[model samples]
Target: MTLPTSYRAYKSNADGYQNLQLTQVDLREPKPLEAVVRVHAVSLQFRDLLVAKGDYGLPTGAGIVPCSDMAGTIVALGEDARRFFSVGERVCANFAPDFLAGEPTPENRAALGGERDGVLAEYVVVPAYSLVRVPEHLSFVEGATLPCAALTAWNALTGSTPIKGGDTVLVLGTGGVSIFALQFAAASGATVILTSSSDAKLALGRKLGAHYTINYKTTPEWDEEVKKITNGRGVDHVVEVGGLGTIERSVNAVRLAGSVHLIGTVSKGASGIPLIPAILRSIKLNGVVVGSVRQFEDMNRFIEARGLRPVVDRTFPFERAREAYKYQDAQGFVGKVVIEVVEE
Candidate 1:
């Protein structure tokens, strides 16, 4: 297949995202190990907002694209690519391509959409090695949300501490990561306690598997509620997305030796935790920054087998891609928000 003259890309900032069109430059044809993907959909994440605003890392240089998650169909492949994927197979690129299994490497760090042009485009070429075959029954939009949020929850729950039957798991918030954590932990036979700001969304969370929920805005001391719900022993695992704002809350709600999967920041810019209390609980805090290709594959299998429906908050056309970013920023979403891209 021949490359085109140009493609579409988007950029973001704290204010929001903006779309841009560019001529396709000569793309390196798949070398022996890479695959060129025709991007079909891109998913929004909070980090994308930070990257766009120039608050995250090294400047993206000029004309850098935004977004880290994408689902697409493989259009071409390098020589050895057939071992893992085939042309036309649906695929999603891993977010932290460098942090494969245990440690991070310099090369994988230059992953798509960070210091590099991400998938907020009509077409983007990724390392053939970075692709994970999307589940046959999944759509591009659903698959797009997997590489980041879903895999992060999976790695946190399974990689560090596998949820056992009857284990009590506490999830904070109705955000994508926390929602995924609730579902994944529930599937593992753990009773789930979720915290959200809205009672309506909390109702939906219960229908999705949350055995209990707290309106954190109403009860600032929701962690105490966590203990009360767990009968004073506290939950066995806590998906701590609140960072410093709720870290102490999470620490207080976890049982002795319980594990805490530190994933996000509901309260950005500052983190305050009662260290002495946290230390006394002998709790475990594992910093989560998404997961590996192996973890992605495992997550896909679980999602497919369980018929897990990722509650999509909404879908926006490519023209409304910036609106999608703003929608994500407004935090009016209950689940993942996706942007659908089309071939020009």
Candidate 2:
């Protein structure tokens, strides 16, 4: 395949996320250990929205490409890349390229869509080791949702305390991470209890294998409902994405020594959890920031072996990327919001 000399990219400026603009620039060839991918699709996450709004804490000087999760066919590969990956394989970039297997370090925390150039473009060059092969059964759109959201959910379930069969898991909300958590936990032979304000979405969760669902809007003390569903033993795991506003309840909802995987701050600031219950219950509050490249590979193997399909609520064309962000911000999505960068 002949590589284009230049390509179009979306850049977010100081003006705001809504002020994103498309610009054409020269596409550089990859280094010896790198690969150039022609992006097919990219998925939006809450962090992407934060970066676009210039509120992600990472520096976004001048402008920055604004999405981390992408799936594409590798168009070009350098000499060393041939050892691990091929020129035509479908793959996704790891969000944190530097952290491949172990505990994350400050250096490894530099992420796509923030400190580095992202894949909201025609092509993206990343380290050869940063690429994870997509499952054979998944479409590019489904593969695109795996890097951040799916992997975060994977890490949450299997990170600190691996979820066991028959254990009860609680996922908050029907967003990408929570939905993935629900699917993964259920597939692992666990009973999943998911909470969403919308009964419609909760019904969707049941279809996705959730054993029980709670309408948090109606059940303000939804944690009590969770406990009731679990026969007062509390759930064995909680995928806590609601941050401060629901952390207290998440603590109350988990069983003794159960794990609470803290994955997001969707609730902004809603006060802190009392450590006394956490201390007394010996609950594990595991903070998950996506996962390592090694974990991505592990997840892909599991996904492919099990034929797990990512739930993508809607897709938009590349030109409507800003609309995709706004739609995600509107928070009506049942799963993931993806932007199709190229046709299948």
Candidate 3:
């Protein structure tokens, strides 16, 4: 296949989403260990919004393409990269390309969409080692949602202290990560309790295997509700995505010695974690930053085995990529919002 010398991509500056511009960029040839992917679909994340607003707590260079997760077909491979991945393979790259496995280190912590250029482009060149084959059962859009949201959920459930059958999981909202956690925990035979302000989304959560649902808006002290539901023992794990706004309650919602996987700070507030209660209860606060490439591959296998389909609430055309960002920022969707780069 003939590779284009230039392709369309969205470039953002410190000015944020409203200033994002669609531009044509020169596509560089991949190095010996790299491969070029023709991006089919890209998914939006809260982190992407942060980056756009210059609030990601990292340096995003001027005019950087913004979006970490993408599913694409490998249209070209560098000389040495061909040994591992061939042209025409469907794949997705890990968010942190260098951190292949094990505990993350400072040196291996570089990530896309913030520290480097990202995948919201017609084509991208990435290291072959960072790429994983998309599951056969998943479409490009579904596969695109895995690198960040799904992996964060996977690490939360199956990380250092893996949950097992009979365990209970408390998910904070119906966002991408929380919804994936609900599905994974339920699939592993654990009971899932999902909370959302919307009763309708709660009902949808029930259909997705949440054993119980709580409308946090209706029950402000949702932690007490969780205790009541769990007979005062609390849940075995909490997928704590609400950060400062909900960490205190998350600590209260988990059982003694239970784990709280911290994945997001979507909730805005001045409140912080309850140190006294967390210390007294021996709460395990695990800060999840997505996962490694190996974990991404493992999660893909489980997704395929369980036939889990990612929930994509809506899709926007490539030309409307900025609108996709705005839609995700509105937080009205229960799941992921996607931008189709190469129409399926």
Candidate 4:
């Protein structure tokens, strides 16, 4: 295989995440077990924002492409990679690179966009085992958002959550993961109670099948509202993104034997958990770190068969990748933010 220098959008330095430029990069010839992707689109996650700030502790150089979620068509294959993912197939690169079909391993845990290079570049070489076929009906923009937020949502929801149809779920905020969880829970026939700081966002959550919405900014004691919404029974599960500021309240909002999917925090560090409430309720708290390849495939199948659409708050041209991160930071969009790499 011949190596060609490809143009990629990269931040000049870790602190320059908001400032990026296109530069020519030579892609290494794929190993027999690798696939090289011609990236079509990438999505912005909080981790990408952190990478710009030098927070993710990833391997980086000046002008690194910073992102985790990407969807693209395969263009190159290693000598022995043909049996895995075929060239020309649309797929999303997996975060858990080495996890095959079931349980995770230490190596599978390294993940792209972290210890190794990630999907921010226009062309990325990934272990062929890590590719999950994107749903045929999903747009590139929507599919790009799934590798991170959607998979994390699916992992957190299915990890230990016992909620079934008729069970109520409490989702905090209207960010990417929460919104995906809200939509997915609804798809499973579970009722969802969505809370947001914005009334407009709350209305939009309702439009996405949330049975109820709470303005946590105005209604600070939203757990009480949760009780009211569930007719005093409390919710069956809470997708705990509110972190230190809201975890205890999240515990307060769940019924006995309920589960909490501890996902994210816009907070500085760990969230405060009220151990007494947790002890009394016996609420199960599970940590979610995206998902394995099998989980992603299952999610794609469900989304495609049900005609589910992953929300795209906005898109930025690949050339404007830096500006896209800045815009995503400034705007608390109801869903995912993306960048389209028009050329590979």
Candidate No. with top lDDT: 3
> What would the per-residue lDDT of candidate 4 be over residues 1-344, giving only the tens digit for each residue?
34466656464466757555566677777899999888899998887777778766446555555677899988889878898777789989887688766666666687766556667777888888889888988878888999989998988777655457888899998899999999999999999999988999999998899989999879989999999888888988899887888898889899898888888876544657888879888999888888888889888887987799998898898878888888878757989999998633
Which tens-of-lDDT digit does each residue in 106-222 have in candidate 3?
A: 988889888889999999999999999999989999999999999999998999899899999999999999989999999999999999999999999999999999999999999
The ten-residue window of minimal lDDT in model 1 covers: 13-22
The residue-by-residue lDDT of candidate 1 on 1-344, one tens digit each, is 56665666564433336534333454557788778888898888877877766677556655677778999989888888878787889899899655566655665556556677788878777777677888878788888888888888888889777888899999988878888998998888899998888999999999999888889889889988888887899998888887867787788899998898888876753657667877887888888878888778888999889888777899998888767877888997898999889522
The runs of at least 3 residues in candidate 1 whose Cα sits more than 4 Å from the true structure, single-residue gaps closed, are: 1-3, 11-26, 57-59, 105-107, 268-271
lDDT (Cα) of model 3: 0.94
Ranking by lDDT: 3, 2, 4, 1
Give the better candidate number (2 or 3) by lDDT: 3
Q: RMSD in angstroms, candidate 3?
A: 0.8
Arrange candidates by TM-score, highest first: which order? 3, 2, 4, 1
Model 2 worst lDDT window (10 residues) = 54-63
What is candidate 2's lDDT per residue for 304-344, written digit by digit as tens? 87889999999999999989988999999998999999977
Query: Residue 152 error for model 2, in Å?
Result: 0.2
Question: Relative to the unseen true structure, what is the C-alpha lDDT of residue 272 in candidate 3, on a scale of 0 to 100?
Answer: 89
Q: For model 4, what is the alpha-carbon lDDT of residue 291?
A: 89
Q: For model 3, where is the 10-residue window of minimal lDDT?
A: 266-275
